[model samples]
Target: MTTDTAAQDAAMPTQPATPQSRAIKEGKFGKVIRTIVMSVVAIAFLYPILALLLAPTRTEHSMSLGGIAVGSLSNVQFAWAQIVGFDNGMFLQWFSNTLIMVVGGAVLAIILSIPSGYAMARLRFSGRNALIFATLLLMVMPNTVLTIPLFLEVSAVHLLNSFWPLILIFGFYPFGVYLSFIHFKTALPMELVEAGRMDGLSESGIFFRIAVPLARQAVALVGFFGFVAGWTNFFLPYVLLPQTQSSTLAVGLLQMISSSQLINPEEGLNVQLYMPELALAAVVTMLPVMAIFIAAQRYLQRGAMVGAVKG
Candidate 1:
């Protein structure tokens, strides 16, 4: 009887080992496949940026290869030209203007969103659920779809030429509000909020002190995304801001490449193929977001992964 019992136990254990081993092997294989796919996708996305950064053997485009002498594509020369072309500090002005738009817009968006999200997620208020649902729905709609209405609204206010129009429009990111709302609702515990209240904190006080403090990672997440959106915004700024005073780097780059005088062949130009100025502008535009990401990658990564559900 003892021998039979031992034999039964050993056979049962060994029988299950095969499936367990197979599952682990399959999991590792799946991870390897995912890694390979992601690596390929990343490389494909980065290839164009790499090619643009690298100096070609000759500075000629296939579009008009027959036009001019092949020259070296020098980053310094192009950037310098972009910096001081047409006796104008155009790039510098655009850089400063973009700084104002991006920073001001992002700061305003975060300032409004954090409290609004906290209130919706934690506080009992009239129309809270309705508002959040409306926000999510509105956010899913393309910004382009709202452009004409927004333009008319800005025009009605007579602030079209001023940076205020663009600033105000971009500063209201419903998506950020939703993201923060979901994050705080799920990741933050009710106990912490209740504790703050028990300690005699006001509703507003509890939000500023406890909720926000605990939800810093998610705030950073919203801030980064909002910043990127504002930074790379094209249509609103291009449409609202007048050509002379408030144009951003994007609009300025377009004008630089479009003006017939700038691309004149008298200066031995190959304007259609490549504008080193535009290339430099592209690099300049991308650098800040890249720097921000590189600097705060750790916190940014955490914030992006805040997979919390909204109550």
Candidate 2:
């Protein structure tokens, strides 16, 4: 054989024509085992979602009868009607309140986080490192730890039992700030900022015209998460707004459960609360977030995968 052909042959690894080698190469058994494990894991993870979906379908009567029984659409309809009819259509009010807080908080968060992140990443200012460090520290801190201090401040300002506190707190999410900082630091092009500066564009003008347009993915990711945080928030709103009428969906759900009479109808409450009603409420509360996530999934995925390619 020629020297080139000999070199080519030497580069290839020789495999034995044996059963063991064939089995190992094919990995049929390993593939089967992997499939089984993945199936089990998937089932385990999906169980909660499945239960949530079915909980509204199964009746408490059937549950008390000691057997798994699937219910009908009537159960869902009844549950929805009861939930809607509660406290003269209070659920709709709570939903509206939740939408206001979530939308307001998310909008405010996006407005503040983007500019702050851009300033931190690109601007040369005094105490910049300290500001960045403070942001990092706040981001790492547990949200619950800030509740008491926020409560005290809100109380001092007499803003308790209103939507403002929720709006302000959720809008100033440190995680959103951190995400914005990371995106601006790594993903944004500094050359554009420099060009804008050369064209006599002010810092604010550059941010609004250049940075805002390019950072849409990051903004969507931050906005979605911030909205979710506000929507699902329990403690802050609960503490701030103690009244049932002013309760957001999360807190209202808790109120619905605590004030429910269906668990043991001996108390003679007019509205008979049941598992289906609670399940329906839970689904309603979660639907907006789920829908928003599905809609913005592409942007979220892009934001997650970005920043790896630094400008």
Candidate 3:
């Protein structure tokens, strides 16, 4: 054999085949491309966060002046308000509101999605495929389109000012259902389920006792997405709740901007102060989601792997 051919043959191991070796022998170009793409995407996502973090601080004079105008005292004061608090500061209240929405929505979505996903994936019942197709179609539905109907329904029920509307709407996490379904369908083996049946575990018992534990990766994936969606929601809450006091962080920020002069009882350029506070409040509102992701990163990684390997 030629020297190059011999070298290629030598690179091939003389051991029994294994999944790891098989995977390693696959083309690496895709991995290289993914690495490059991920690096670019990471930078793209992080730059804005870095900018927000590095935003100029507000001093007392800046706060007094009300904004961060060049050579203006209010500008400095506004920056300090970001680090500190604004008049009648409701930053913590807004933070609490956002947390309630995320946590409540995530829990409810998980409760419904896991069962729905399992039913769609494992059950051979009538209309199963139809339901799956319908769910897939929901991904294309504009969330904006759903808001008006949801608003009308909430109005009919007189739930406009309450937090229920926000949480409930986010809980109908169709995408999360699809995600869970795909994960459960692909990653779970049928033999294990049959074994559970042969062991005489009731369907419900088997599902909870056997299947649920194995589906951890998918469940975590769904929960993470549902939580994030709940966190970043704006339009549904805005349209549904018109009361300034009843609004979430997104809608509350809108109220602040729209009624800046009217709301600020203090004599300073309150609008400018509100602007900086707005930016600061945005950062505060997003912190929980950031914390959640950081905490659940291991699960997220596992979930991602489950999807990838199954696909």
Candidate 4:
């Protein structure tokens, strides 16, 4: 009877291992290694932003003392005052210029990209593939490579030292066009478009009523990217709008730093600009892009989910 019981117990299968048991059996060392690596990468990316945030809290003189140290709000106020008082508030002018260009360019980019993308994705026509190819080519092309040509063209048209050239150039966003094309081509239902056609709706009617409404996420994505591109663009604007009054915040920041006491102490001692103020300016410049990203985050998330499910 004991030998039979032992044989029956040996025949019975062992229980499957749970995930936790499996992990323990496999050893936790790999997981620990992965966590350590990811933590290091996170710190590397976040440390610069942390330093920037902390720098504005302390005075330049205090910054030389040691590590990132926090000071009173009064230091921030003083930095802001100095920034506002510099050259009779040139920072304000630069801020306004950046706002106008970023907004206008983003809006225009959306307006143009949506329809063009829809047409390319839906309509069959001569040169459609070629046009798509051209767009893809231009999208991959470096902005610096185009700079000299754009400069020459703008100069020939005598539009230098003006906002129109920047606005128009920024509005020409091929990446947005490509993005919209991909969204429409992959995610949008052709059945709906055909149904609208059978109902005697014009292409424009189908687009405005169906396509545009459905593409809100793509539009937001395009607008956000366009805004970021315009806001952060330095080389193009610096070349075209050389005048300080016409400069965007990005270009103006460079000018501020170049003329500041930190860089040229002998000549800039009388200048009110310092590390704290510059850090504050950097923070201000980043705020709009951050706000836009936060606001569009939901749409971006939805878009990603939709894309994943569709294709």
Using TM-score as the measure, the top candidate is 4
lDDT of each: 0.72, 0.80, 0.71, 0.85
Best by lDDT: 4
The candidates, ranked best first by lDDT, are: 4, 2, 1, 3
| RMSD to the hidden true structure, all candidates | 9.2, 8.4, 8.4, 10.2
**Ten contiguous residues with the weakest lDDT in model 3:** 54-63
Cα displacement (Å) at residue 13, model 4: 31
Q: In order, how many clashes per candidate?
A: 0, 0, 15, 0
- lDDT per residue, candidate 3, 13-55, as tens digits? 6855566764655468988998999999999898776645433
Q: What lDDT does candidate 1 reach at residue 222?
A: 78
Error of 3 at 272 (Å): 6.2
Better of 2 and 3 by TM-score: 2
- Against the true structure, candidate 4 reaches a TM-score of 0.87
TM-score of each: 0.76, 0.84, 0.72, 0.87
